[model samples]
Target: MSDILLSAAATAACLPYPALADELAASLTDSAVTVPPRLVQPLPGGASLFVMPANDATVAMTKLITFTPANAGTGRPTIQGDVVVFDIATGTRRLVLDGPTVTAHRTAAVSLLAAQRLAPNTRGPLLVLGAGVQGRAHVEAFVAGLGVREVWICSRSPASAEALAAHVRTLGAQARVVDNAAAALPDCPLVVTATPASGVVLDARPREDAFIAAVGAFTPSMVELGPAMCRDLMACGTVVVDTRDAEHEAGDLLQAGVDITALPSLAEIVRESRPRPAGPVLFKSCGWGGWDLAAARLAMLRVCAEA
Candidate 1:
């Protein structure tokens, strides 16, 4: 077996969104290996820290280090971090994957994957409710997965929204910047919320037919969806998660009074479902160790091939 290690930068350079998503879905459904649990720590300095560790036979080992500082000076409570990939077989450090970029792509891809299974008939005009890195990744992954025809980028910052719209336009997708979240919501069948907000950004009550992907909140102290969203998810379509253990760390679901018993595990969704979901569905991912290892392993293969 070829032993290859990749740094974060190198991994980012080699891993593209479309290919990564394909690899991720296959890895997620694989029955051979067990995904390791996430390690969470309470930072005494006022930051919440989380570490996701995993290894596939080819990838060797991978670790994703994430930090969410207390919302003191900043209005947003977002995650910031890095992912390190190592080759255990050779004792070689492979690469440091760009935490922000990788997180954005992987998270969005996860949403896209869930959307693919949950809402196959919904074609966009997709609405993205954030203009940050995560939002951009959603746009990329959505187009890659669903052939999104148009995208409406909405954000607290008009200029940032315009910038993202312009960037998306360059990718040949019809794009526009919108200031009102409500105005953007009705035009699209699919919505993705990638903001770092502590409360609901979009009203989930009115849009009963819209499929949503919420990937922003990670801790019990932060929330993005309101009670209505959780209620709808619990009652309507299947709410798929990467792992139940990670959901315990999410502030969005816990604070919204979501019952953990109602949500279905990802593996169950893949194996038990028939014809998939036809109506509104929601996927809340807190990230998982298996995805990190899969991405890292793919990046290492590229690095080894180049060598």
Candidate 2:
């Protein structure tokens, strides 16, 4: 058939947090899915072009986007592009989904899946570091998908933090803006660090049994967790990576000298059906193309059903 374009709103509407999370959970165990290493090419002015492609038995998908760090606070999005989906049999483009929307929702859905399987508690008052796009997506995921009652937001920019907190409040969850995210760690068992930090944001040690999802700092030079805290996470709790890609991209665990190979993949945890560990659970997500593929599949299904 003809190609269909889905805007940001339409893309998000098709993949709600609950259904998206379930799609990701199922894709994790589907052996037919194949995601290759995404290509990141650096451009002048500190911009990056990312090309991520994946496929299953039915459709092939590619997400092409640009990441411009200099755009922060400039009213321009740092990530922008489109996800093109094609029929595997015909090789004809079937759909085009908003790139950043797919990235934001899919990433958050992955985090939700990890939390549902790993977190000690999915209840309220979760602490979130960073108030950017990822930060907002995560808050919506936790509150809507996991039924969190309250959210504690922290960010370097006061205005941004308050914005996120305000959004959280509108979602019917209590929102708190904190000057020190580390200080709020003990009370908020479920924590997410979505900051694009070159150093550390969460410097304090985590509670013995807290669940933390570190989504920012994908490169080795960037990190959100302090060395002491990273070490403590491994020593006192189990650290899981969303995929093997974290070994190369997960700065939080790498900078702390944590052996990523020793950690189990999220797929393993899902398949084995193991009991939750007694200590803290740190889940490091570094992004994957299969997630975008899952988004495409869901969007197509929803679109077709509507048609």
Candidate 3:
């Protein structure tokens, strides 16, 4: 077997949002793929690294592997990443991709998938409570996948919010910048919290018919939504998570006094035949290794085809 290699620039040229979401969803729902246990290492400087191994019988003869290393230092608190793809059958290295862009796409795709399932009838101005990479990606994903009419972005820095909003408008989305989260909450039926805050940023009770996607704070020490969000989730629609194990380990739910018993896995939500509870729905994702592997594999395939 021969292996293919791809760089961050090459991968970006081939991986599109809609296609990535479709591929990831199929891999996630299919029973044939085998995703191995992820290896995680926390650095002394407060950074973290993760390695994921995966294979899908329908996709290729060789298994796909991906490595992601993220760092959020104390001073800068930057989240930088890198992805490497290898072909197991040929023992060849396929690609070295940029982790940040790939992560933004895949994470937003997951959020969009969750929103599609959980918030079927949602409309009006959507609220994004972060202006970082993830925040911009979320807007792109939502515009591509949902029926959002307008977007309101809130960040600590007004300039950052304005910049992100400008980008969103270029993508054919009606967008605006806001100074606070509360101002955006009242009119937003869908709220996404993507900040890197170590404490709560959105504390108000959600609207009766809203949906929330909280993707920040993957570690035990960080949080973007407070106890009120958890309590709201319990009382409202289903709480879907990428993996209950990851959430339990990460402390996003546990730290907020959220009962694990009340949480439902993403698979459960997708398979449910009956009507779900009324009110807002919450989908909290704590980055999973399987997602990285799946996305990397797809990106690598594109690199090979181009070569």
Candidate 4:
């Protein structure tokens, strides 16, 4: 069969968050998913290409992506890629979905799933770091899945941040760009860090009951939360991650000398029905490959429905 193509916009339009969440939750609990570590090939010019493949009972999918941080200066996306879906039963390529959109939706949806079970709401506005794809996507996902009345964006590029802020305003939220990310943290009940920074991004003392979703630092060499902040936040509430692998892959957790095995995975949280703590809770994601499988399967289903 010919491969079906799903663009980023179409993929986002057809994304099934609830179904994807349920699928991921089940896979985590049952260990039915196979998510191999991604193969990374970095170019000499500081660009990186990542190839991640995942499989399950229904489908096998692989995503090829590139990260070119310098592309932003040229008015290009820093992240670009596509996901190829294969029929596990027939061993045939079936569909191709836009990579960034799938990644953005799946990543944010995973965090949203955690937020639903953990810190459901906060008293203040939502603060997001970075103005790129993941940053804007997280904002939209949170506002869609939850009730976000206000949003504050912090970015290295004022133009990008303002652009994202304008988009958020169109989404019916009070959105604005803030100069100080650290300063904005204390007042925000929900904070998302989606930058590519190699060092700490959130270093402030947040609200007693705040929720943090760290989505940027996916490698051991990169960190989003400072050691002190990580320690303080972990001490306040349960720290949940997307997968067990994050314990080793997440620099924020590792640099903080956090015992990853002790922290609950999102699956464990869903399986055990862990009660939300009264204090703060942090969700650190290192980007699970299994989630790609779930997302691709969802896209394939949508393609079939349309056909």
Q: Name the best candidate (by lDDT).
A: 2
Residue 307, model 1: Cα distance from true site in angstroms: 2.7
TM-score of 4: 0.92
Q: For candidate 2, lDDT tens digit of each residue in 45-107?
A: 988999999998998999999988899889999899999999999998889999999999999
Model 2 regions more than 4 Å off: 1-3
Stretches > 4 Å off in candidate 1: 1-10, 64-81, 206-209
Put down candidate 4 lDDT per residue, 221-258, tens digits, no spaces: 88889999988877777688888888678899899998
Best by TM-score: 2
Per-candidate TM equals 0.87, 0.97, 0.86, 0.92
Across 27-108, the per-residue lDDT of candidate 1 in tens digits comes to 7666754576777777777666777777665455545554655552375535666667777778667676666556766777
TM-score of 2: 0.97
Of the two candidates 1 and 4, the one with more favorable TM-score, higher being better, is 4
Candidates' C-alpha lDDT: 0.71, 0.89, 0.71, 0.82
Q: Which stretches of candidate 4 lie over 4 Å from their true place?
A: 1-3, 16-19, 120-124
Report the Cα lDDT for residue 232, model 2: 82
TM-score of structure candidate 3: 0.86
Predict model 4's lDDT versus the native. 0.82
